[model samples]
Target: MTTTTAFTIAADGSYAARLAGEGDALYAERWTLAGPEAYAVPLPLAQPEEADSEVLPLADGRVLIHRRVAERHAFALLYPTGAETGPSTGELQLGGVEVREGVRVRLLPPCPAGTGAFALAAEDTVTTVWQVTGDPSGPRPVARIPGRCSGGVWLDRAGRLLALDRELEGITKAVAVDLASAGVSPLLQITEDSDDRLLLADPDSGLLLIRSDAPGTARLGWGVLGSSLPVRFPECLARTGEARPFAVQPGQSLMPETCGVALRLPEGDIGLWRPADRQVFRLAAPTGWLGGSGLWSAQGRLHLPYATPEVSCGMVGLDLPVSPPPPVVLESPTPTAPRPVPLQQAPLAGR
Candidate 1:
């Protein structure tokens, strides 16, 4: 039985994933708004004998399909007319991106709160970031940064700032890239002995999720950027498994939480972290499904994709209550540790 992993859930609550069944097929599943189940249907795509491809979902429900063709990457925008059926390939448009043959070119997630534009990260010697607005046929390269871009996550809600973990100067550090000014700055300086990766950050609240290995064990920590104090996971919450930052839910205050996770199980150990309480909530794996794809929804409802023992994959919905950070500091603070200094606000679109 082939296993499937949850990739990314779109801004419009649509779930896009790849099912590695007999062949690699992308599944387009419809997630009900704050409901308890998902209606998933496989997207029919022509499989090349032995090639690589990706599915990028647009905010308007159209998906851009990128596949390597004739030593070059080919792209087409797929607009599915229904959730259960696959889109017709009648209007498939080839890409206009001219790149060296066999060079790795990948698609980044779409900005849920931004102007609905997504990014294309190409890695040669250095990483080149390209922005694709409404045109998949004409994706223009935007910023170029030194070191290899591992991947980037939005630092703010507007997608103005992106934090990318790159191997620069022999150390992995989180570098912040401002989309407006094309400005790149070092946000987190990971040490030689300890490694850190930026998961997600909320500039408006200065709340950030960074995977840190300083404690001799890989753990998830929530930190307020620029604050003199340290980002701490409650001592009560033992870090056995692993967790990464998912998406930031929309909200004005903390209680529910602005951010979430897609899937956080490393060894069947599932853990949840709350910024308001600064504690990690541990949950046991559910029967029939060992793990979930990832998590997100505007309403604190978690849309999770899971694989059964039958080698089949499906989506499940969970209504989770939000947790607030602890009212009083329980864990010791790291006042002298290097803290994240906030970046300048990026200008709004058309400003």
Candidate 2:
């Protein structure tokens, strides 16, 4: 039985997969179409802090890892330790800094340029957007959008910002803010009274995906720009009456080329669906206790970390083939022999 824990793919199509034994440390290995081989490289992140680390691939071909440094609730961004031996040590910067006591820092996704921008949900119930420019040592506030912001997405291409504002009356509305003029407008109003839910806006496709509770199950609903009602994707609905969607891939929009739904199942299996064909394929599964999973690179490969059945703990790399071949079998060879030679020779000798 083979088990894979974590996986990442380089630009050149080579893959790095990590596996762990029953012990404390994690084992990382590299592989290619040639063959699978193990490398004596340091694990991406260290021991106890491994559970909280998040890995994101940058536009510059480098990987950004966000690790929690200490119990004081501080995070440090570092490059992978075994990344091609280019840089010995990566620069560490503090994120979600405590501006005031008891203020928790929930770091949002950075922009595409890796400019170190994040959202801060303050203890006073105010949400502000902060930008860190130049060096990692200097971080400054760029702009602040008013109205208790819970979740937001940067519309870089459209030059707009979509944020969710939670009202005091327990109503949430999707607002669109113009970055240039700093004006805010209500785009969609969610009257479901679900403050714990999240709203996502895909800038590329200009679509919104909402997580809300349905009649008998928790489900995800998709909405286009001009549509009054959302078209629900039944596959994303939960089966056990649980309203939690485990793993959800952000809606990716490559103009004129839209891919379908990609999410993880409750059983720890990753699946990708193409809406046009209504097809679904399994990407990976948990061989042990999977810590976390996400897309490793922009090329559409997934990275997952879990306790390996063979080793202590490890990671697995899962890549969906461009076009997987159908199952086939190879025929075996048949033996040939000189049949009646012995019988003919005995008859001649007797004659």
Candidate 3:
């Protein structure tokens, strides 16, 4: 019953938080990734958290745990107690967010600034985004978007802008939320009648990995933030069944096409590819992978974290090379070819 968002990495990539335990004894665990050897520290409270509870890592090494109690969602900060406090941990309750009986709430991805955390409270026709931390007063509502929103990706390094897939009138489109101004604008609308989602984004290169049915079927594609170029879906990505992109190499500020992408395939294998290349090289996934939990470095290195019975905490660093560009193929003009359309209607500010 582990929640899908159980594993999360801090915005700075120095720490990770996840729910780890066997059977009925689940607790919060934090991994120190900035050190030479990765290790995990358990932060178990007097009571075990339910399997469905979500944990998010903060830049300061504290974990934000979200639990559902009746019609309210409670929040708490968990940290390891100092040695003087004796081999234990401390939990500071930050209160809770109340919702209607049938509404559901979930934690959003960590903000890029690493100073605050956020979550979404969703109902039938609207979703409320809340800033859960970084304010002395307490958790407060940031924006009330007009749709059933899902999928969260930070579009900038400052964490001021967030992209969400919003479903309205039976159509899903990606939109950007300005946390500073509480404004919403279109981010991705591949077609008038199609579902488009922004799965992952790299702020350094402005590379956006997307999935859309504009090609008649949902397929993986890549687009730039401010560029008017249309999204490109390579045939190679279509060969794989529903590729789930997990990480994109950062620090390629000028070359978004060369950023390495890590994908979790449908067959339980890991695939590495780049927008410049048309091939996906597959690798065997490590055991006990908090599936889809990983980070990429500016130097084209990927770090994947996992925990198993044999090894309590471990990280795998893979230096995946950027694939060589494929040769260009000349094609004859065809009457039935689809037209190239920009994924987004307009370039967002601060891109």
Give the candidate number with the greatest lDDT. 3
Q: What is the lDDT of residue 76 in candidate 2?
A: 43
- Best-to-worst TM-score order: 3, 1, 2
Candidate 2 CA-lDDT value: 0.41
lDDT of each: 0.54, 0.41, 0.82
Give the Å error, residue 70, model 3: 0.5
Tell me each candidate's TM-score. 0.73, 0.56, 0.91
In the range 257-343, model 2's lDDT, one tens digit per residue, is 233344566556666543232335655566663434433334455554454437443445666445343322222111221010100
Candidate 2 contains a number of clashing pairs equal to 19
Could you tell me the TM-score of candidate 2?
A: 0.56
Best candidate (score: TM-score): 3
**Which RMSD does model 3 reach against the true structure?**
6.6
lDDT ranking, best first: 3, 1, 2
- For 109-204, candidate 3 gives per-residue lDDT tens digits of 988898689999888899999998877777899999998999999988888888988999999998998888888988887668878899998877
Q: Put down candidate 1 lDDT per residue, 70-185, tens digits, no spaces.
A: 65655566554543463443235645466666456776765756235555554545777776555544666678888777767775556677778877665666778877777788
